[model samples]
Target chain A: MSELEQRGVPEETRTEIMEATFRAVSEHGYAGLRMRDIGEEMEKTRQIIHYHYDGKYDLLANFLEYIIEQYEGSVEVERDVPPCEELDIRIRQCLFGPGFEEFDHWERMKVYHELFTHAQNDERHREIFDEHHRRLRDSITQVVAEGIERGDFRDTDPERTAQLITDVIHAARERKLSLGHDDAPEEAVQAIDEFVVDSLIVDE
Target chain B: MSELEQRGVPEETRTEIMEATFRAVSEHGYAGLRMRDIGEEMEKTRQIIHYHYDGKYDLLANFLEYIIEQYEGSVEVERDVPPCEELDIRIRQCLFGPGFEEFDHWERMKVYHELFTHAQNDERHREIFDEHHRRLRDSITQVVAEGIERGDFRDTDPERTAQLITDVIHAARERKLSLGHDDAPEEAVQAIDEFVVDSLIVDE
Candidate 1:
């Protein structure tokens, strides 16, 4: 019975390993990362990894939690729907809002790719993903439905319209990340401005 | 002259290493993969990798080339401006044409992440990413501009509008990947479908 016994893979120790694993996986990815590498990066030992987490899978679940936490904490998560009329505005407000005013697309892009790749093959991973980017799509769909009810949006399918909005948002993030370079400027951001307005505000 | 001192790495041998690296990297990812694994996968020796490619960078370049050949080669690279009407159709045709039709999003998604992350610190890497995607974005903008001039699309800012289109497409791909395990049936794809028709089809 020593420090290892005291620690004995407690929640705190598990969380620390998972957090470090997140960085390693995000920077390197799932395939190349080694137990020793994680230990070295965090200045711990491989036994610590074994002690706190059963193995890679245990560490993966916890790493996924961190990935999803960032998502819910992102500009997209919603607790309650906004008025149908103002959902678009809310979306843009959060996207380019002062809260994320200091956000850097490049730094976040790798973590996104890491989590997203897992989301494809891992069920728990996808839950974490949808948990984050939830409601924006539904809200958009509801907006379309509401518009139809209000006799504003077109008579087309609301659900379909919602998916497109989701698509647009998803696609924009990819382009934004891939296209964001040191040389790229504000003009890049300006280019996609008002996309939501155009997509949804049916021609009068 | 030994293997290194020989005339050069034979093109077939070089191509083999590239092909082997492509398979290895795709399965294990750039960081997770190893030179030894690439050799074993290809049924050759580690020396074969050294003979054909300098190291990881060289393997990555060749892998990138394979991606371009396998993936980019499929895209209809139209450099010239098509007629306005044709251009509009082309935009819809490529993006809305298929959600999962042309390429499996998983492999392409990984390749995308690979190039994008590598581009963070490497100018040449960014250059490759910039060249392919910017061309596609520019193409969409040109179409929007033409539609505006000829009065096909609405009188909106073509530059900004085109970016929005690009963004939505980007977002849609992400949603497809991110929603990999959503309990929702193809509802997400349906939403994107309607959005395309709404976004591109002009009001009569």
Candidate 2:
């Protein structure tokens, strides 16, 4: 059972609170975030939010976990989807999907990046952020390994190649976050399609 | 005259203050940074530091400018260094350089990342961070253009290739900042050297 389940929080209530936290982060950029602000966004009293969370840190930590769960759920491959296509879809979601343009999605990603940067100094933040990286990178690595086993890709180091693809997608997102204008999923797709995926193509 | 020069601050005094800012940022990260802490680091009063900078934001804005200047100075190619080799060296410096391992350098970078995350919501921070990206990308673009002009590289789009390389270096740094365990610049260097630089190499 998940933390929310163990705490007896209904999934609907948990999601509403998460959305409220998202709004708070969007307005304040994490550094300026306050539990009261989140509570206000949710149309609830701070005490009500406090009942659900230890404080801002605990709420945000669970928010990170919630985000990972949502992402993992989104990227699950269907029976009909080829592993390579699935990988491409995941890259698109990360690099240039509506996530980059939709204000809510963009803000959520920005908050995520903020958390990653903060993790450099804080151990607890590092642990939470690292889990996200491990899950995402491991998922990509598994896809690449499967592709190689299916003879769709050359015998390259699956782990390193996955990391390279992961790095590129992240770099693209970071660029968008920092510079505020970039070729969206197109540049990212091209980079991955040409450099990463193409590099792994097996010769006939 | 430059901002520092117009202020009539002596070069020696400016360097000392910059070093103090670096130390303060290392200890506090940028979000927690206080003018008092920086002044204390320099063994001066807050008023003395204020005489040089308006406040925390102003001081850090100038500090960001100072860092970009330092980085630009470091990446300058020598007259005898080949353009391609010069580019490789720059990648090494950015991605896997001893700079990332040295405590002072690592902390400074962490602070820079913090500033960047803050910039997502702060206009002033965005301006400072954008200048760094523009200068760095422009520098990389120039090298790629030079390589193409000299026939050392194929007729690839220098601008896009430069951005690709820029993304790789940044992604590598972001990975290190988040994961805390990654191949020292070697992985980044290899990714660029093979995927980027090799792709641009002309056939004999």
Candidate 3:
């Protein structure tokens, strides 16, 4: 059982709070978000939220985890899928983001990056972001390694290639969200195809 | 004369205020920063700062411009340097950052990203970031165009190539600073060499 499960917070209640937190953050932003704001987005009162989490920081820390969990969980593919196809899906997902029913991907990413920037000041937040970064790079590396083994990709360092692709996807999202460069995501997809994906594939 | 010059704020005073703002933001962060905190970093009184600027947001808007100006200005190369050399220097400078006497690069970047993230809420800040992003990409695009023109690089869309390189550098720095992945910058350099720079060069 997870720590959250051990704490007696029901899975349904936790997901409700996470969704509320997302709505609140999307509306008020991280700096402006309040328990009251989150409560407004849900049927529960602020007291229940306060009872479960210590304060704003604690709740936000958990929300960050929840957000990462959602993204990580959403990166699904069939077992029969080719390594290159799986790699492409994962890369595009990272760059363009997964579609969420509650909020737009970039909207959630704005809040995510806000918390991400704040991670520099908070140890807990920093650890969470570190884990997220590690998982992202590792997942990509795994796909690249599979591709190499299957003779679909060149004999390159999987870890390094994954890092490059991951960083570009990250940077592209930041460019789009922060700088309002509407074309950054599309441009990044094309660039990845030409530079990264093409370079990784073995010549017939 | 520039708008700053026309505003009657002396160059020396503007630079002093910008430096103090940097130090203050570094200490307290963007969300926590105050005019008083900025005042403490300066030899001049708070009233003097108030006399020159309206409030925290106004001062910060100008400060954002000033930070971009410092970075844009610092990206200098000798007149006769080759396009590839210039591109390499610029890329390394973006990923690793330029040296500054008063503060560390990553430390300052933490503060910069904080503001960049906040740009979403403020139109003025968003415009400033947009212009900075454009300039960074354009300068790189120009270099890539020159390289292709001289047959140093393979024929490719300079704008697209530059966007990819610039985004990776930005992401790598953010990864290093926010996630505390200390090796991110170095790993990015290696990735760029293998994926981007290698792909761009023409084979004899």
Q: Best-fitting candidate, measured by DockQ? A: 3
Candidate 3: tens digits of C-alpha lDDT, residues B65-126: 88888788888778878888888888888766789988878777888888988887888999
DockQ of each: 0.39, 0.65, 0.84
True contact recovery of candidate 3:
0.89
Candidate 3 docking classification? high
Q: What is the interface RMSD of each candidate, in Å?
A: 4.1, 1.5, 1.1
Which model is ahead, 2 or 3, in terms of lDDT?
3
Residues A19-40, model 1: lDDT tens digits:
6675676556565667766776
Rank order by DockQ, top first?
Answer: 3, 2, 1
Best by TM-score: 3
Estimated TM-score for each candidate: 0.68, 0.91, 0.96
Per-residue C-alpha lDDT of model 3 across residues A114-145, encoded as one tens digit per residue? 88888878899999899888899999999999
- Cα lDDT tens digits, model 2, A114-192, are 8888778767878877777878888889888988998988887787777778877887777677668656446767877
- For model 2, the stretches where C-alpha displacement exceeds 4 angstroms are A97-103, B97-103
Top candidate, metric lDDT: 3
* Distance from true location, Cα of A33 in model 1, Å: 4.0
CA lDDT of each prediction against the hidden true structure: 0.56, 0.75, 0.86
Q: What is the lDDT of residue A85 in candidate 1?
A: 36
